[model samples]
Target: MSAKFLQILLIAMAATFSGCRNNSGDAHEGESHEGHNHEAEAKSEAKADPHAGHNHGEAPKFQYTAYSNSHELFAEADAFIAGKKAAILSHFSILPGFKAVEEGKITAILTVNGQESRAELSAPTRKGIYLFEITPSTAGKGSLRFVISEKGGNTESGTGEKGELRKRGNYEVIVSEVTVFADDHAPYHALQPEPSAVNTTVFTKEQSWKIDFATALPAQEPFGEIIKTSALVTSSQEGEAIVSAKSAGIVIFSAGVVTEGMSVSAGQTIASISGGMADNNPAIRFEEARNNFEKASADFERAKLLSADNIISQKEFTDTKNRYDNAKSVYDNLRGNFSRSGQSVKSPLGGFIRQLFVSNGAYVEAGTPLMVVSQSRKLTLTASLPQRYLPVLATVREASIKANSQSPALSLGELKGRVLSYGKAANSDNFLIPFTMQIENNGSFIPGSFVEVYLKGLSGTNVITVPVKALMEEQGLFYVWVQITPELFEKREVKVGRNDGRSAEILSGLQATERVVTAGAVQIKLAQATGTLDAHSGHVH
Candidate 1:
């Protein structure tokens, strides 16, 4: 073979070998790409199927329930995982016979271990349902806290299980916890939109314990128009007596110690009066009169014997007899009252010594006004009312007296009294009509003490009422604290009608069977001003 032919053959063989090697490499790369595609497809399938290779084991299902102190409010939670977000479906309802809550404000929070995530709450729809969505940072052993605030047209605090919520002026907090699993591809059902919004104060059980709060239910009772006015307690004319000096003399207290307010009985000797050394002194007059009486009596007796025996003339015997009779009458009249020492001054009636006019060793003239004794068992209440109330004066069925602003009012029914009289016309000075009521004093009333009078007209139907202490006033507007729950209270505006200082009638903004804060209302007002108020924690069940 030629040399050139041999070189061409070698080149051809080398080229062929290189081409085969390249083809083999291409085949291997094609197999590797196909394997990678298959692996990716398998992974995508596993992720799409929720029950593929994942094992939940015996993990407890998520479940939660909530209720308010008001039997009318109820809530339930259904939790599940949806992709990377955790969704909670909340349903609320009112009892079968109660009025439905029109709308509510809702807030939700999710906590996993120590990590917390705020939830996006959807407004409630016509079905009264809400949905909460949260993208949990990490999934495993977590809880969801839900808060729902709702109000009715006539809703007030202390009316239901939402007590603490009412006090803090917050919505009812219904807390529920459920163990959940979190995963990016977890399967969860979708929920419809339900929109709502609310802001409320939360007064927790712990907070209530700190404040030492209490509550009471409102009641339906007989109520009437109350006419308020000022009054004066005075003594009745028949219940008073005046002691006066009977004659001119020096006064001396019978008991060494006689003071006002001392109890004395009828016929008790209060003092003694001794005549002074004057021309009209009773002691000297009695002595001189006695001497004359003795002389005249002896002369008359002798004359009488002579006349009967005809020993003296008739005219002389008659004159002597007349003188003796006259002197006898004088001695008899002064003998009982005129003693060498003094004359006794006694009380004619039994009562307390209300006043003392004469001091020890003081001189007093005859018929001079001295001291007054008052029987306080019976007293008179004089109340002045505006002329406008004159038409209802005769129809007044009840009355009460409060001695002072801080004192409790005493009712006429309890005191056993009635209206005695009323002025026919208004007074010239104040244009106020005066009315009097006689009261059997029970030792609680004091004469001359000013008081407040409440006169009630005829009773009407049963109405809601609360103690006066429950009311709070601001800028002439009246308000009250109603217990929403044991520890929760809400401030509410109220329209007040008749008030008797102890209790007031509610004409609007309050309901029967609702509870009110009879005490500590002022403290609540202060708390609202400082913004330190809180509501009870959401119920955990």
Candidate 2:
């Protein structure tokens, strides 16, 4: 009872002084009185001291997070008290893209003691934020909600896709429960504030909307065994044609310079053979054939009439007709083809020039190969697989192909592709077995270019997977950004199983419903280096 009694008395006196200072400004002028309840004040101080982590200058704040088909709402408001004014801060963000809502009407409704009060804001003080002030007339447990409406009905419900949400009208966003106390001196007046997450990175809607940012939910998809290998893109079996010289002569390209990869059409003259003063000179040969055809025609006409009138023998008419037919055949063949130049070399098929066998002005013999034109509409993707894969080659039914290292892998099925053939055994020259797939070009693939291919088997199992772009690497460990809230993202380390050059199978460390950053993941990783941000930075209360 010696030192302890003195310490207790001093602490009680100090608490009394602090309470008097807090209520000094609330009293009327000259209305001071003496009989105060020190025990009640001490009990209130003890309850409030445990929540000193959060600022409680005047009143406590309550936070609620909610989501709608169209938008996400995160709201914070002052604790409800009878006849006291409350300030509410609401943040709105659009879904799918998670961009801030630039324009809208946000209504905050508070229902307490069988009565309702509302505060409305037509526009935001800042983008994505709306502040509301309301007063509660009575105090009790109540429900609070927000109704959002926008003009022109342009707001999307989900993904902005058709049938995802109501084509027109406003919607409500559901949030956490609401509690109203009788007064500030209630039993549950104060509580410890939530600690900020260390690993959660904040990517603001303003920052995300400006860049190429997007997110997608992880999904369980059918994934098959992948045999990764290199492939060669080549023309299909009937997609290539070789143009040959019909007659031997000096080659002259038609009009402009002809080069490899130049587009050509069937019967289109790509070059001409000039028989300058030679035996194959089409100019001289054409004239001779014309003269011979004129003589043969006159003789055949007279022979036909004479044989019918019994003026000539049947054998003579037959001989005349044969000569006429032979002369006409040569004339007709050279008629359209012959000119000042020897003969026109025409492409047999419409395609790009894959190869030019002979240069301009080069002499070539009859039937000499001139060029190769490929109708690249259909292409063959050939992959060389080791002998061990031969056993599973027959089970392979589809392929995923990347035209180049920078391109995303395209599905063979989507390209109207199918397995053409596969070698049962490895060839003697090279020990690797060849596997070929026929895929429609879709104007995306180039012939003779090497590509990365993933040969997929017929059997598969459903597994969680994400696009390969979503995964980031750190010291050989793969990680992806998983969005916990609209703006808060947590980096999760995952064990990658199989990658088909497009989507990767996540063996662990992820949930199917969690949305992951499919694009602009690097931006978030860079933000992590900068440091974490207070998610509630712009709060008004």
Candidate 3:
């Protein structure tokens, strides 16, 4: 073949090779496009997964606590995952009453990157627990607020108008520092660590509602120095009276029975003095006065006749008239007071008979003491303190008195009382300084009864205190039940300082913000003895 023919053949072969390369590239491109479609389908299937974030494990529970004027909200929610459904559980409690919220509407609003989403529950699943589910729209940092609509929806006029159902009140609890993670693979840490279960007691809301249960935060207040002592309850000067005999005779009780503590009214006849064989007898005096009056009348009549005949001087007639007048007056006075039963003795004031000085049918002389009456509306507390505490007595500002060991201490301020005086020198009998306080009786104080007294001094310092009832004595140490959450309480040993009957000072083992069980502590103690405390009550699940 010629050289030109060979060149043409080479070119044809090169052109064919180039066409083959192009066909191979087209086939490879088709495979690549198909692989891309497969990847796209895989991604779409992953997005449709119902349990994408939850596949690893259950989400960590996030808890938030908030308070409103009407209610307290404790909320728990499963950590958020973007484009995934999560569960939220809310516990609502009424405030000031601390009862479970039986009925209400709760709404959870979630906001992320200026986008907002909400989930609402018409009513609580349980009495106070409202459980619901929410889905986060996007993955980023977000915030949540729980809006609660109290039961008994109010109207525009706040009077429950027909067909106008506005919520009675909407209480909002904001959850801060909330995050929506892209996936569940990342480590999560809760905002607040869960409280430990050790030394904790579970007092359920149901149990608390069934009985008298109450809680109060430790009060930061000025606490005064305390001086503890015993006191005697006695009737005040204005609250007591002495009943005396108006005449000398035998004592006779009225129809109504007279005894100690028997109530009497002012001007009510309680007893009578009858004539006896004694010299001061009313019957004897009456007879004497009658005889003397007869003699005086006889003399006065004879003198009057003589004076009419001008047989007597003017002075002698005047003397005779005066004697007759005196005799008549004496006779009339004896007759007025001397009855068949003799003289009646009436109570000078309204009160109860405190002491009977004489017995019925007993002989008594004139102006003799019979009985003692007490109004009992007011009382005086007299206490004796050691001479060493004289400085404290001078600084006393107020006092608290307890009638008995089982009774609670009564504050002088609350009883409308005041310190009357403090003794300047020690008494000879007890070698102690005397102190007196006047208090309104309130029917609890009994005269002559011994009581516990706590004199509060003026020197005070700011400290935290709780009601005296909050303390429970174990062996000798003082313990208090501190509330960790709404239902969880831990028995904490507190260092007790001065206590003024009603309140106790906490030197340690307590915080001002923490709450304590003021009432029903004994019930908890009994429950503790019975092992009724649930150890796992702190777990949200």
**TM-scores of the models, in the order given:** 0.49, 0.69, 0.66
For residues 412-506, what per-residue lDDT tens digits would candidate 1 score against the true structure?
Answer: 87788778988999999999899998888888878878778888777768888888878889899998887654334677899998887777989
What is candidate 1's CA lDDT for residue 453? 89
What lDDT does candidate 1 reach at residue 462? 85
How many residue pairs clash in model 3? Answer: 0
What is the per-residue lDDT of model 2 for residues 1-541, given as tens digits with 9 covering 90 to 100?
Answer: 7899999999999999999987875664575457667788777887888554435465566666666666767666777777888888777777655677788787888888679888899998688888899888787777787888876675444554112654435767766467777867662445445534756798865577667777777868777788999989999969999888877788999966999989988889999988765576777788899999999999999998899999998899999999999999999999778666678888889988999999988989889999999999999988888898877788888778888777778998888998989998788888889999999998778888888899877656799999999999989999999887657888889999998888899999999988889988999998889987766654555
Backbone clashes in each candidate structure, one number apiece?
32, 0, 0
Superior by lDDT: candidate 1 or candidate 2: 2
Report the C-alpha displacement of residue 385, candidate 3, in angstroms: 1.1
Instruction: Report the lDDT tens digits of candidate 3 across residue range 1-541.
Output: 6999999999999999999999988877735554467678777877898545545455577766666555666666787888888887777766555567787788889999988879998888877778778889898887888887776555332221122333467767677657887877552543356798777787765576566776878988877779989999999999899988878788989855788989889888888899776666777777788899999999999999999999999899999999999999998887765655677777889998999999888989889999999997888999988888888788897888898898889899878899999999989987988899999988788899999999998755689999999999989999999987756789999999999998999999999999899878888777777785663354345
Worst 10 residues of 1 by lDDT: 191-200
Model 1 — TM-score against the truth? Answer: 0.49
Which residue pairs in candidate 2 have backbone atoms (N, alpha carbon, C) closer than 3 angstroms, thus clashing?
none
